[model samples]
Target: MSAPPLLVHLDGGVMTLTLNRPHKLNAIDNPLAQALSEALSSAAADAAVRAVLVLGAGRAFCAGRDVSAPPTDRDLELVQAVSRQIVMLDKPVVFAVHGWTVGAGFEWMLDADVALASADARFKLPEASLGVFVTGGLTATLTASAGLARAKATMLLGEAFGADEAQAWGLLWRVVPPDALEATAREAAQRLALLKPEVAARFKRVLNEVGLARFDRAIALENAAQQALQTGG
Candidate 1:
C-alpha cells in the first residue's frame, strides 16, 4: 500500500501536519486535499493541539494542484474547505514553506496565520495563466497584505518569485536559510502555543474580522467564477 498523503503528529502543544506526497512535491490531489481538511478540522477540535504547523516533506513545500490529472468538483470543494479551515481555525496556524509553492499552495500560505519560508523557496500564482480562479480568499488577503497594484501584477503575470521577493511583498513573516526554516518555524509555533487558548482564539477572531473583512465575499465570488469556468458559463 502507498503511504498516507498527510502525516499528523502532536508534540507538546504543537500539532505538526506534514504533507507526505513528496514524489509530486506535496501536490494537492483529491486524497491529499481531503486529508488536509480532515487534519485541520481535527486540530480545531482537539484541545491538546494548541498550535498547528504545516510542513511539506522532501524537496519542496507544495506545487499546488496535481496537474497530472484535472481537479474534480470534490477536489475543488475540498480545496476551498481546507482554506476556510486554515483561516477560521481558532488555534494558531503556522506554515513553513520551501521549494516550489505554487497556485493553491501559495494561497494556503496566505490563508495561514503566519508563514515562514526558506531562502530558496519560490512562489507563483498561476491561476490566471491557467484559466482558473484562485481559492483561499487570496483576492482579499493578497491585496490587503501586498497592496492592490502589487497583488494585481503578481496574480495577472503568474510569474515565479524567490523567498526574498515574497517577504518583500509582505507575504512571509521571515525568510531563513534553507537549513534553518524548520527550527525557525517551530520556535514561532511554540511561542504561539504559549498564548492562552481563549485569548489566542479571540485575538485571531478580532484580527481576522478587521483585516479580512472581505474574505468570505471573495471566496464566494471566486467559487462562482470557478463554477462558471468549469461549466463554460
Candidate 2:
C-alpha cells in the first residue's frame, strides 16, 4: 500500500503536519486534501497542541492541486475546509515553504498565520492561465498582501517570484537560507507554542476580525467562479 499523503507528529506542544507526496511535489489531490483538513481539525481540538506547523516532505512545499486527475466537488470542499481551519483555529498556524509553491499551495501560505520561506522557494498563482480562478479567499488575501496592482499582475501573468521577492511583497514573514529554513521555521513554531493559549487565541481572533473581514465573501465569490469555469458556464 502507498504511504499516507500527510504525516503528523507532535513535539513540544507544536504539531507538525508534513505533506508526504514528495514524488508528486506534494501536490494536493482529493485524498491529500481531505487528510489535511481532518488533521488540522484534530490539531485544533488537541489540548496539547499549542501551534501547528506545515511543511513539505521533499523539494517542493506544494505544487498545487493534481490537475492530472479529474477533481471532485468533495476535493474542492476539502481544500476549502483546510483553508478555513487554518484561519479559524485559535492556535497559530505557520507554513514553512520551500521550492515550488503555486496555485492552491500558495493560497495555503496566505491563509496561514505566519509564513516562512526558503531561499529556493518560488511562488505563483497560475489559475488565470489554467482557465480557472483562485479560491480560499486568495483574491482578498493576495490584494491585502501585495496590493491590488501587484496581485493582479501575479494572478493574471502567472509568473513565478522568488522568496526574496515574496518577502518584499509582504507575502512571507521571513526568507531564510535554504539550509536554515527548517530550523528557523521550527524555532518560530516553538516560540508560538510558548505563548499562553488563551492570549494567542484572542490575538488571532482580533487579527482575523480586522484584517480578514471580507474573507468569507471572497471565498464564496471564488468558489462560484471556479465552479462556473469547471462547468464551462
Candidate 3:
C-alpha cells in the first residue's frame, strides 16, 4: 500500500503535520488537500494538541498544486478551509518551510503564527501568471506581510525568491541553515506548546483579531475572482 499523502503525529502537546508526497515535492492534489483538511480538523478538535508543526517531507515543503490534476472549486474550498482552520485553531501553528514553496504553499506560510525557512528555501506566487487566481487569504496576508508593491510583483511575475529576500520582505520569522532548519523549527513549536494553553490561545486570538481583520473578506474576493476566471466570466 502507498503511504498516506499527509502524515499526522502528536507528541508532547505538539501535533506534527507532515506533507508526505516527496516524489512530487509534496505537490497538492485533491487527495492531499482532503487529507490536510481532515488533519487540521483533527488538530482543532484535539484539546491535547496545544501547538501544531507543519513540515514537508523529503526535498521540498510544497511546489504548489499538482498541475497534472488541475484544480476545481472543491480544491479551492478545501484550501480555504485549511486556511481558516489554521487561523481559527486556538493553538500556535508553526511552519518549517524548505525547498520550493510556491503558490498555495507560499500563501499558507503567510498564515503561520511563526514560519521558519531553510537557507535553501525558495518562495513564489505563480497563480496570476498561470492564469488562475490565488486561494487562501493571500491578498490580505501577503499584502500585510510584504506590502502592496512587493505582493503585486510576486503574484504577477511568479519569480522565485530565496530565504534572505523572503525574510527581508517580512514573510519569514527566521531563516536557518538547511541542516538546522528542522531542529530549530521543532524547538520553536515545542516552546509554543509549553505555554499555558488558555493564555496562549487568548494571545493568539487577540493577535489574529488585530492582524487578520481583512482575511475573510480577502478570501471571498479571491474566490469570486477565481470562479470568474475559470468560468470565462
Candidate 4:
C-alpha cells in the first residue's frame, strides 16, 4: 500500500506537516493537495496548535503539481484553498524548504510567515514556461516580496535560482547550512509556538491587514488568468 501523501504530527504546541511522496519529490497531486487543505483547517481550529511547520519528506521540498496526471478544476481549487488556508491562518506558518521548490510549491512558501531554506535549495517559477499563469495569489505575493521588476523577471524567465539568490531577493527569511536546515526551522517554529496564541494572532491579523489587503483580489485575478490560459483563451 502507498503511504499517505501528507503526514501530520503535533508536539509542544507546534504542528509539523510533512509532505510525503519522496519518490515524486512531494509533488502536489489532487490527493496531496486535498490532504494539505484538511490538515491546515484542522490546525487552525486546534487551540493547542500555536504554530505550523511545513516540510518536505525527501530531498526536494516540492516540485510543483504532478504533471503525469491531468489536473482537474477540483485539483486547482484544492491547491488554491491550501494556499489560502496558509495565509489566513492566525497561527504562524514556517516553511523549511530544500532542494527544488517550483511553481505552486514556491508560491505556497511565499505565503508562509517564516521561510527557512537549506543552502542547497533551489527555486523556480515555471508558470510561463508551462504556458500558464501563476495562481494562489503569487502574482501579488512575489511582487510584494521582491518588487515588481524582480517578480516579473522570475515569472517570465522561469529560471532557477539558488537559496542565496532567493534570500537576496527577499524570498527567504534565512538560508542555513544544509545540515542545519531542519534544526533551525524547528527552533524558529518552536519559538513562535511559545508565544501566546491571541498575541500571535493579533499581530498576524494586523500584518495581513496591511500587507495582504489585496490578497483575495489577487487570487481571483490569478485564477481567472490561469483558467483562460488552460483553455487557450
Best by lDDT: 1
As for candidate 3, its clashing pairs are none
Model 2 over residues 17-96: C-alpha lDDT tens digits?
Answer: 99999999999998898888989989988999999999999989999999997766776788788888898999999999
Taking all chains together, each candidate's TM-score versus the true structure is 0.98, 0.98, 0.98, 0.98
- What TM-score number comes out for model 3? 0.98
Q: Which pairs, if any, clash in model 1?
A: none
lDDT per residue as tens, model 4, 14-122: 9999999899999889889989999999999899999999999888999998889765678779878998999999999999999999989999999999999999999
- What Cα-based lDDT does every candidate model obtain? 0.93, 0.91, 0.91, 0.91
Provide the lDDT at 71 for model 1: 55
C-alpha RMSD of candidate 3: 0.8
Clashing pairs in 4: none
For model 3, the superposed segments whose C-alpha errors exceed 4 Å read none
Kindly list the per-residue Cα lDDT of model 1 for residues 94-182, writing each as its tens digit. 99999999988999999999999999999999988888888889999999899999999999999899999989989999999999999
- The C-alpha stretches of model 2 lying farther than 4 A from their native spots are none
What would the C-alpha RMSD of candidate 1 be, to one decimal place?
0.8
